[model samples]
Target: MTIPQEAIEAGAQTLFEESQELDQDNSWDDELPEEWREAWRYAAQSALTAALPALERQIREQVAQEVEELKLNPKDSTTPHCVEEYNAGLTNAAKIARGKDQA
Candidate 1:
């Protein structure tokens, strides 16, 4: 089938106008080929999927190791230090309140 020149010109003009609009909008991603975008997305997703389990396992192992170390040396744990500080503060506050009541 023979295509008319007017139809070809119209199609070309439409493409040119769309390209100009895309350029004005300044979206560089729109210029990338669809296949390239799809492949990049797939690779990124695959990498994340592959790495997530190892990342999670590493985090869990580190936490468990820290917990075990804390158990082995409870004197170095922040929890005991915080509890002692809180208790001391409470005792001081009680003494201050009692002194005010007496006054």
Candidate 2:
């Protein structure tokens, strides 16, 4: 079967960029078509799939920093649960408005 070179290259790139090494004896060297292999290599180095988890972790850390800053604000009067309460209230209102409430 013919495979696009883009797929193999992408895969290889992703794997290498992630600092991952191939198992010379067991990796997808001779199994997949040449184009597919190239695309895969490309994916290894350039695809976002490999970096998604790392990026997500970074985002979470940033959000945590913002939360910490909010907690440190001396003039803030709201408790940490304040946002949770507001969200719950809004959810209840939406449910009632949609005629899902028993009462």
Candidate 3:
């Protein structure tokens, strides 16, 4: 199945929002000086912000690759059920046409 662009955007937005929330209320690095911890947080946030585009691109590429693989080798559950129904409809139409022609 193709991953919708909206889903990808939501995933990326979640990552960015979570990253923003990091170190907001918790002190995880007790060993480090307060200044060091603050600096580390700043650097981490900046790195994540700068890398957001690349991260989104990677997510898109990975999803596309998985979708292509599924298309090439779909499992029984993933196979289209509508194809059989469509074929059956065509057969019914042909039979009706044949009956009309004979009449």
Candidate 4:
């Protein structure tokens, strides 16, 4: 399965953001040796690198599930809303599957 560059970038950004939050005081990693911190950072980045494809797949599956749910709930008076949501989810899922950005 081809994972989108956008998804990879997003995953990396998320990691970075979370790390930033964890280090809000700018000293969260200060207790560790510099080399150890470097190694830990490398490991974290490597993990993110390895997990991006699976993450993309998870996103696709979740979108598909949402679309299916919307389809199954057509009995409600919000048919138009459900249809719109289903279409949007399906479209986003297709885009992710194809390694493309949402339209």
Best by lDDT: 4
Is candidate 1 or 3 superior in TM-score?
Answer: 3
Question: Model 3 compared with the native: what TM-score?
Answer: 0.40
Clashes of 4: 0
Candidate 3: list runs displaced more than 4 Å. Answer: 1-30, 72-103
Tens-digit per-residue lDDT, 9-101, candidate 2: 655755644443533433543455677555665555555555656765676566545444443332353674776555455555544543356
Clashes of each: 0, 37, 0, 0
Better of 2 and 3 by lDDT: 2
Candidate 1, after superposition: displacement of residue 20 in Å? Answer: 27
TM-score of 4: 0.43
Q: Model 2, stretches more than 4 Å misplaced?
A: 1-46, 73-103
What tens digits encode model 3's per-residue C-alpha lDDT throughout 18-51?
6557735433323536674455555555556677
lDDT by residue for model 4 over 1-103, one digit each (tens)?
A: 4455555555545555577687754343356466645554555567776886887778777765654554434355466687667767776776665556777
TM-score of each: 0.35, 0.29, 0.40, 0.43
lDDT against the true structure, each candidate: 0.50, 0.52, 0.49, 0.61
lDDT of 1 by residue, 3-103 (tens): 34444444444444566586754333357566644554454455455666776666655654543343323376668877566555554544443332311
> How far is each candidate from the true structure, as Cα RMSD in Å?
22.4, 11.3, 15.8, 9.2
